[model samples]
Target: MMRPVQEICFFVSCGVFLLHGCGRHPLEVDISDIEETVHVERFDRELFEMKMDTADHAIGYFYERYGDFFDIFNTHIIHIGPGSGKRYPSFLSMFINDPANREVYEYTGRVFSDMEEINRCLTNGFRHYLYHYPDSTLPRVVGYVSRFNQGLFTVGHFIGVGLDQYLGSDCHYYDLMGIPRYLSKNKIPEKIPVDVLYAWATQIYPYNDSVDNLLTRIIHQGMLHHFVDAMFPQLEDSLKMGFTGEQLTWCRKNEAQMWTHLVEKKLLFSTDPLVIRKLLEDAPYTYYFTGESPGRAAVWLGRQIVREFVRRNPDLPLGVLMSRRDYQEILRESRYDP
Candidate 1:
């Protein structure tokens, strides 16, 4: 009887041990197993490389003449220095090296399908600048390749840094389109693939940190957009061309609503240098639709200033108009008053 009782106790203990596990803690399960994959396309590396090279050459030429401005820019605009060890490769190299980043580039290309046209406009504008403003300090050959390296690192960083995870898995197709009307019309999946490739294009490099900082600073300066716009009128046509007929129609139809949104969001002057720099630092998503911080700011600010100026001076010609030296001198004299 005693033996039987002892045997029963032993079996009970064995059963409990088997059910609970043999001195093992409960295993933790990862949530990733339940996560879904985001689907998106990649960018074309060769095309991107070509574009970057063009921009780089353009910027290099500018720097050679305006090295002083660059130095001042580094001091006043950019907070960081070359010693910070930031390393930015060419946009193409970054994209090819990181397979994960391709999606964003494809999305960017789709949204801005007329990028080549826009670039052409820039090239033409630069050439015009050289021809008309022969005495100006601006570069004569503002090639795409030259401009590519000027602030490429900073521009890339503003777009790419801290954005991989946000874009890689959370990006939606409609989000890629910069049009608010389109985004409102199409509802995308909650968790879409992030476009990392675009980030590669916008990646910030160590050597260009000063350039990035200075550009951001200059963008913040009041009236700078107006200066750029007065200098480059072809940009307006280029931007308009980026929109399709349907898109333009949609924009017109929703003009009131769009303006309302812009006013409410303080985006009407979103191109203001200060406003743009803030947006770049604070709202990366907004920057994407707007273009990189200073670039988008330049466009938006140019439009705003021209609209106001044209409204006041309706007699002004639609063609490229130059501000008289006296007017610039007066503005400079009164700069502190505003």
Candidate 2:
């Protein structure tokens, strides 16, 4: 949807932060701590390499092979530039640099791993739908990985949720779905038309049971869902309009039904930088700030939090509000410092 002018201002501030070297730091954990040996047979490696050579060919190959089982969103792909490889490392370093994030990341990783295992079991029993119908037009899996990396930056820098902290709220889902919805509603199409792009990002295949189910699963597995729900009362009124609880529930349930197939195939799990490009390109919402970076979202959210805090506690000084440690403790305690 149309972003408020304040949001634009917030975006500008985030740009300044980045320029000032205030970007999220990387985690201090050694690569060996989280790295897994990715095994691909010689034939698999050859095929994967061939697919990577041409983006169009890779998209087409995936769609031809698995289009039937999944609904491919027509999201734009971000082309990875030469220096972009450092982005993830940079993001991780932020976690390592911040004591709060380090604590949160440890907990979050364990929770995510647990959820992944459960999802693996569910997929094994039901079969992944994305594997059955891959779409050629769909963004590559690597693209998703990149988006996740950016997500880390936003969550860490703005929310200050430690790495181990489970979002434990519906906020994550609200963000995942809301950002795109806002982008689509605002008519800010990437290179592609907004409607076409929205259709792709929100498209559901036959495998997903319903949007409600999808929401339920996401909430059950991730902590962010709870956070979203907590802020819903405040944000919904401020935004002027948004989905009601019932509507969101219905949409999420239906979404789950539609995407079950894709989830089964593991198409949703990606780490490519191209995914971020596609998301921004296809976003329907515009920020007050101008830039191609995903940090804009974090800035917007940070501003919102600041505004809310000020409104609730008019007597509080701005200096205390900006204190990272104090603010983080408040967030961790689930209380507004104001």
Q: What's the TM for model 1?
A: 0.28
| Model 1 Cα lDDT, one tens digit per residue, 18-41 | 223355322111223222221121
What does candidate 2's lDDT look like per residue over 209-293, in tens digits?
Answer: 2322322222121222112222121122212122234433343344333234324644233333353233223333212222332
Off by more than 4 A, model 2? 1-95, 116-118, 121-166, 170-245, 248-338
Model 2: per-residue Cα lDDT at residue 319: 28
Model 1, which residues run further than 4 Å from truth?
A: 1-123, 130-134, 140-246, 262-305, 314-338
Model 2, C-alpha of 327: deviation from truth (Å): 47
| Residue 46 local lDDT, model 2 | 23
